[model samples]
Target: MTSPILLTGGTGTLGRHVVPLLRDAGCEVRVLSRRAHQPVEGVQYATGDLLKGEGIESAVDGAEVVLHLAGDAKNDEVTTRNLVRVASQAGVRHVVYISVIAADRVPLGYFRAKLGAERAVSESGVPWTTLRAAQFHDLVLTVLGKMTKLPVVPAPGAVRLQPVDSREVAARLVELTLDKPAGLVPDLAGPKVYSMPDLVRSYLRVRGQRKPLVPVPMPGKVGRVYRAGGNLTLEGADLGERTWEDFLAERVR
Candidate 1:
């Protein structure tokens, strides 16, 4: 029997999509999460905390491939380092990591953490594959939802975003996890890029609401980086088919 593939962040938005796909491909999956879950066919749950470095050895033991999808707004570097150390010690064959596009270019703490996580994966002395993807449609929607709640929505000036569908990213990740380790594959982004105001306008139109949009200038190095499109990958990147309009049409009432 083939060994089960260990998956971190199996309970997250991306991991939720990946687990079913891996199972459909005739692969046993072990999901390492912080919480316990009810039993499911062809899927096993391993309760562990990557940040606290607990129960990782048992989670990684006997797993040939480790699909690490777990991440957060902070502490991703520390969590990834913990996972890499255990996976390395377990002799895991392949370690697949999902990162954000321009993780190294963006001058933010979150981006720095992501880049640090990437380094941890690459320097783990194990075969690894990393794929950087643009912001997810779900995340964009969440941010827009919160911003639009305010009386006047604040749109960052000269900032644009390419929000890809999570399903498409999940499919690509599963393919990489199944294949050999190909270090730093092409970036994945949405088909179209939308300025901050345009994105806000679309959200307002979808919800049949109107609000004043104030253009807020992003300041300092982060602003300059965003204005220069540091968070984007225009060429030599794989684009997803779904657009923000398509996502809003389906998700919004």
Candidate 2:
């Protein structure tokens, strides 16, 4: 059997795609879930909880690679530190983590936790690779949905973003697992940049909702950062064919 790969968050939006890709690559995949479920053809489910540090050692015992992708934003730092400690003890050869782009750069609560997690992964004794990617298309879609339902469609002033498809991100993740650890790879972003109002309009056009867009400035330092393109990777690498429009067209209608 090939070296075992243990994936956390294997049932998530991106993980769902990665599990199959790894299996197709002839890897023995073990996923850490909270409860037991019928196993897939070549996959094993290990019961574990990062928050409580339960079942982690057993999960990491024999796996050569550990893909750390599970964690709630609120407590990601705790999860990451715990996972790293166990993976180091387990002698895992390679640890790969998925992170959002500018996790350290962004001051959002979740981003701060992600930055801490990244720090943990970097300091883990095991070899590791961290891929920081742009926000997922589904997230942008959610924002659009919320904006359209508001009393007025107010857009963040000059706020720009580059959203990538989660599946494409998953494919890159699988590719990284196959190669030697390269530390931090280039930031992954969408092919194009988009303004908030434009994205909302694109979403509205697809949904057949006609609404007037009221452009407004986002308050606070976070807003200022976004307005200045803090959340964007205009010069980063990209690996997604499905645009925000493409995702909406396919999924919304």
Candidate 3:
């Protein structure tokens, strides 16, 4: 029989996909959350808050592996440290962390937080693995949704994105959980690289919107990084199966 697994952020986009995978694999799954949630088949929920370090001990108790998926890009450092402390005390064996691509190099605040969280996991004195992935397609849609509301669409001409499906990322995380603790795995990206204009046009196409595409530069160090492809993983773009356009067409249309 396999050991029980403790998951943080089990209700998140990626976590929701992962829980069923684990359950189908016949592994007992325990979820840690901040609020009460109705029961679901093949899963158990424990109330906990990572920020204030409340209810974490019970969440980590007797769990051989801790799959950490929940994090606030703004304050994940504290949350991650709290998790590490509790999980370590509970004698958890392996900790899996999900992070963004180029988190160590990016100048963005959230990226910085991810890097700090990665360090927390690595330095926690427990066997751990970290998987850094490109932006999820859901996030891309959120950005596009905001742009569609504007009278005119401002498109970033210089930036490119390879948005992977969150489901694919979840699969990779599950695979990593079963493998021996490798420090950090290769970055994962979508099947194709798309410029900001290409993605926006596709959004407009699928949504049947004819909003004028205004070629605009995103102003800031973050924008400059994006324009320079700092957020992209060129070699990793071949990792996932789904493309941004297909994702939009299937989900958004």
Taking all chains together, the TM-score of candidate 1 against the true structure is: 0.99
Model 3 Cα lDDT, one tens digit per residue, 34-153: 998887776789998999999999888888999999979688999999999988888888999999999977797899999999999999999999999998999999999998899999
**Number of the top candidate by lDDT?**
1
Clashing residue pair totals per candidate (backbone < 3 A): 0, 0, 0
- Per-model TM-score, in order, reads 0.99, 0.96, 0.96
Candidate 2, after superposition: displacement of residue 96 in Å? 0.4
Residue-by-residue lDDT tens digits, candidate 2, 50-142? 999899999998888999888588998899899989999988888999999889777789999998999999998889999999999988888
Give Cα-based local distance difference scores for all models.
0.95, 0.87, 0.89
Residues 155-237, model 1: lDDT tens digits: 99789999999999999999999999999999999999999999999999999999999999999999998999988999999
In candidate 3, which residue pairs get closer than 3 Å at backbone N, Cα or C atoms, i.e. clash?
A: none
Best-first order by lDDT: 1, 3, 2
**Between which residue pairs do clashes occur in model 2?**
none
Give the candidate number with the greatest TM-score. 1
